[model samples]
Target: MERIEGSGASQLVQLIRAIGYNSEITFELATVTSAPPQLKIKVDHMNVELEKDDLIVAQSLTKHMRKVNLNVKKKASISSTSIDSLYTLTLPQGSGEWSLLSFGLNSADFKVEEAELEFTDELKKDDRVIVVGMNEGQTYIILDRVVMY
Candidate 1:
């Protein structure tokens, strides 16, 4: 059997319809900038009180007050199996108007699919770098092959 000299092994090449072979083309994309969602926490009642940690702040529409306290409690604690294990803020009224402001991740299971991997980070410890996939019973993270500086 005769072999071609100076030729590499039989390789599979991905080709585009109009574009020819993409062997020498490499993508060096610039960094990506993402802005987090703007979340507003407003108490629907005048007598509503809000507390993040040990400090407490009151919200009163009658008093024309509309600013939330910026102090956050800092502590180390293990996460609970139930979502309620994290701190639950008390709304003035409602069965449980408290939404999960942040979640802590004790452990995570990850998988790469189509060169994408998704994950979640515990806000308190992970500098909010944890990733999360938002789907009912499908909370998984999907990270793209792209990298950010």
Candidate 2:
């Protein structure tokens, strides 16, 4: 394929790309909201209506390889007075404490166990993502994470 320069070239490139890949499969711009397994995406400029559970992710796109913000303050509990358990203060960030020692009591109320670790980072609202799906209403796979500048 010949490389062309400038804004016109980009669209041409996308068109040419379709020739190599199946034309039935097309790239689309979508907005992500909510969370995984129930992710809500709004496709731009298409009549096709998408819904929850309609999208599956490409594992590579969901890779934890990228460094991300750890998590901001929320309802967390204090685990101990010592520095060792200070990190757990951000675990649930609430007053779910239960310590007889009184000094080491800021922990989740015995309910937020291992489930907290299962939390997946969700794309912020209005973040744009690319999806490749068949026009025949097939399940769309998120190509990768994208941010609209």
Candidate 3:
């Protein structure tokens, strides 16, 4: 047979190398200099202006009070026979149909919660966010806001 090198082995090597090429994934800290849906964000310490068209903002940042559908369970024990029913027992939070089911006297009970908060007026200038660079920085996805409270 003919030699492999003289055939297409050189071109084959290039294709193999490209296959192993990792996607440029980077996490960058950015500040919103203008409101989102058209965020004029500036990369912290870098002269990079993230384009709005190439961004994927989280729904919570765009929508006004997106309901958080998180699955959380809490247990509360009652040691009295008089407490047959629960009433006006304050939960952590909620907006959806939550449940506080009782098992038995010695088994205790559980709680599920949910909530939604308005955010249409939330994201604004000077708000910091986490931006992820994909496709060699040609596209950026805004993960979420960086907050401490």
Predicted candidate 2 versus true structure: per-residue lDDT over 60-89, tens digit per residue: 644244433343243345554465432233
Task: Tally clashing residue pairs in candidate 3.
Answer: 2
lDDT of each: 0.27, 0.59, 0.65
Worst 10 residues of 3 by lDDT: 1-10
- Against the true structure, candidate 3 reaches a TM-score of 0.46
Model 2 scores worst on lDDT over the 10 consecutive residues at 110-119
Cα lDDT tens digits for candidate 3, 1-149 = 23334224333433444555545776667789878557778876578677678788877777566556544345455455565665454456664454454444444455445767466655788987877778988788887777633
Deviation in Å, model 3, residue 102 alpha carbon: 34
TM-score of each: 0.15, 0.46, 0.46
The TM-score obtained by model 1 is 0.15
Q: What is the lDDT of candidate 2?
A: 0.59
Candidates in descending lDDT order = 3, 2, 1
